[model samples]
Target: MNERVTPEPQRRRRRPTKQGIVLSQQLIIDTALRLVGQQGAGALTVRRLGISLGADPSAVYRYFRSTDDLLLAIADELIGRAQQGWQPTGDWRADLRAIGLRIHANYQAHPQAAMLAAHRTTGRTHEIAAVEAILGILRTAGFPGPEAVRIYHAFVDQSLGFAALDAAALALPAAARTADLQVWQASYARLDAATHPHITATAHLLATDMRRSGYPYALDLLLDAAEARLRAAG
Candidate 1:
């Protein structure tokens, strides 16, 4: 007996409405990002997106079968934005550092988008290209294949993991963010040396430095360890 095969779903083609506005995939994704940026992640619903785009909510379904599909596209767009105009210098370590920082900065700029895309995999063009680019950097660095793959995995994972975390913090309300900063200044800074000796010892530095993002320092540490590994392999 022959088995019947299920037909693949066809993609919907978009056309101009009576209102004379044409909706493209890029417009939908860009509008979604702007909506999140302006009103926070909670504001991203099909209705709100349609309102922002000045179209009917059902129009979105033409391009994206579901909200999840739209979000994945938005995630890929963030990756695309990060890679724009980024050139890799020949120095492997330097190139890795630059790419990592670029990715982090783009995600930081769109914290709400970053949070939405954090755990999800787009498996789209931009993301695939980024993976290839990073792996190529490792291969060019003279690390053996297995070692290069391991390092690449760690580098990308650490970068995205931190980006997600920092994005969450960035997405906090204005008052909440202020309160977090004030905690380090007013609360941690005021701790008694005798009570919390370690924190109190670094209290001055904490009040001054803790307010700044530490991802750069963390990246340096990872690179430093990788360099040490390269030296040991020599």
Candidate 2:
């Protein structure tokens, strides 16, 4: 006769959760980036992000010292993606142009993040690294110390300024966008009718390609100048 043997219940091991307090910071930043992409930076707030993430509002504070800290993180993320796999090409102008275009395109991809990062410099690690890289490249090109600094400042200003302007334009209401277009169109139409040689004579050609050669053309022109300067010095 076998005695009834009742096996004791085995204790279940707790499966690891992908999301928890450990992920809270990354989650908040990711959610913030999404909201920023859709709505624009103005709509991004700690409280709002917390609500969206179902986390405590102050939980962000644990990772970021302040809202500015969070914004810098967002900037690093936005700008950092373009910098993935980026390496020095030794040709200063070419490298610089590549960097400028990459940075600009990255901002354009995320207009809200662009708008936020454009104005706020939290001195985040990536931001500093970008600056240092530019300076190093300029030095490699044999730019004088002062000249390198000047050109670096101008280069950064151009990239960030244009990105901010573009992001702001994209954020405008449809009516505002239309109005902006129409105003420029009307100005060109009026210019076309002017009798002055400088004003009306070239207006047809000038007004036709308002955005045709756009920012890339301008960037190319700038690169050409920088290249010329480098060649002259060499």
Candidate 3:
């Protein structure tokens, strides 16, 4: 019966004029980080992050062109933190190993993120800082500029490569990972006597010492060799 042009339903009135804090780029990155920390890197997407942040999904696009950009940012941040954690105590070999271990530990701290960033090149400010720091350490250790840069390149390749591999290993299915362990175990268990008497004689020690302990030792040895070469040149 009705002249029911039912008074046009009142438009929803905006609740108030209080200044609302809009999410900024830093906040988005921070939120994305928390999401990665909780759900792993694979779970991070612009839409999911936006959902988590209570924002329009397209908003995240303005901050990151895509997920890879977001990941690279995170990698730079994590690597920067790792660089900050290591205190170089005068010995270049020790300091370099400290850098390597810190990188390994940082990736281990966030396995998924590290995996995504494996071999990623950000050219970020922190990366430049890290290179500068390495060069400084090498120069302090008496490596001439060219030699320092060479060693710096090698060091960075191994540090990030190994860290990425370690992260991937962590992510591997348990059975596959266990199979890898089995291969290592098999190698450790059997050392031929005639061809490798030294290895056979100290198989246990060799296996235990060479596995993870040796990366640092190897790094130190290489640096010592570099030092010897430098001394010879001088």
Candidate 4:
């Protein structure tokens, strides 16, 4: 004797539009990235996303449970992009520096996208892979498991923290960005040695360096500190 099997009903999902663009999680994430790149993070609401996708606002909920979920996806996307084509050299410091710079550049490329989610730990595949890579670099550099984890935490946190700060500046309106640029030249450059000797002495360096992301130099400093600790423990 055979028993009849009952099929489970599926949840209702928004259908694709007349133009034939399917509504998938990747589509939503890509659309969200485009929205962020073009209009900044403030434009990433469900209504706005739906309008961008030409679907109902609820359609996005089918993929991401909330805005936070969408942001995490975006963050993972950023990490995946950064890690693309990355090759590791035997020199752990150089390899790690390359990764740090790539991550920083990726964030700068999509300033609003970074601002949306750089600080959060997405715990997704890409994020986990990045964490593993960094930890591996530290471990290869002779740091023990606990030491590697500690350095990895500091390295990643500091990198993303700088990325967020720099992205915030980049995400500013054109006029504001220009005004900020002008300040280093106009204000700092003009300061007399008597009033602000340090500023006067390093005004040129400040003007040149402040206009760019300082992540590379900062990463070097961080790597140096970690190296010192590693040597001290030996």
Best by TM-score: 1
lDDT of each: 0.84, 0.72, 0.71, 0.85
RMSD of each: 4.4, 11.3, 10.1, 5.9
Predicted candidate 4 versus true structure: per-residue lDDT over 44-69, tens digit per residue:
89898888888777666667767877
| Candidate 4: segments with Cα more than 4 A from true spot | 1-15
Q: Which residue pairs does candidate 1 place in steric collision?
A: none
What range of 10 consecutive residues in model 1 has the weakest lDDT sum?
1-10
Off by over 4 Å in 2: 1-24, 195-199, 204-208
lDDT ranking, best first: 4, 1, 2, 3
Residue range 83-158, candidate 1, lDDT tens digits:
9999988888998899889989999999988998967789999999998998898888878899888998888888
TM per candidate comes to 0.89, 0.80, 0.73, 0.89
- Which parts of model 3 are misplaced by more than 4 Å? 1-26, 34-41, 186-214
In model 4, the number of clashes is 0
Separately for all candidates shown, the number of backbone clashes (residues 3 or more apart, or on different chains) is: 0, 0, 0, 0
Candidate number that wins on TM-score, 2 or 4: 4
Worst 10 residues of 3 by lDDT: 1-10
* Model 3 RMSD, rounded to 1 decimal: 10.1
Lowest lDDT 10-residue stretch of candidate 4: 1-10
Which pairs of residues collide in model 4? none
The C-alpha local distance difference test score for the whole of candidate 1 amounts to: 0.84
C-alpha-based local distance difference test score of model 4:
0.85
Per-residue lDDT for 129 in model 4?
Answer: 95
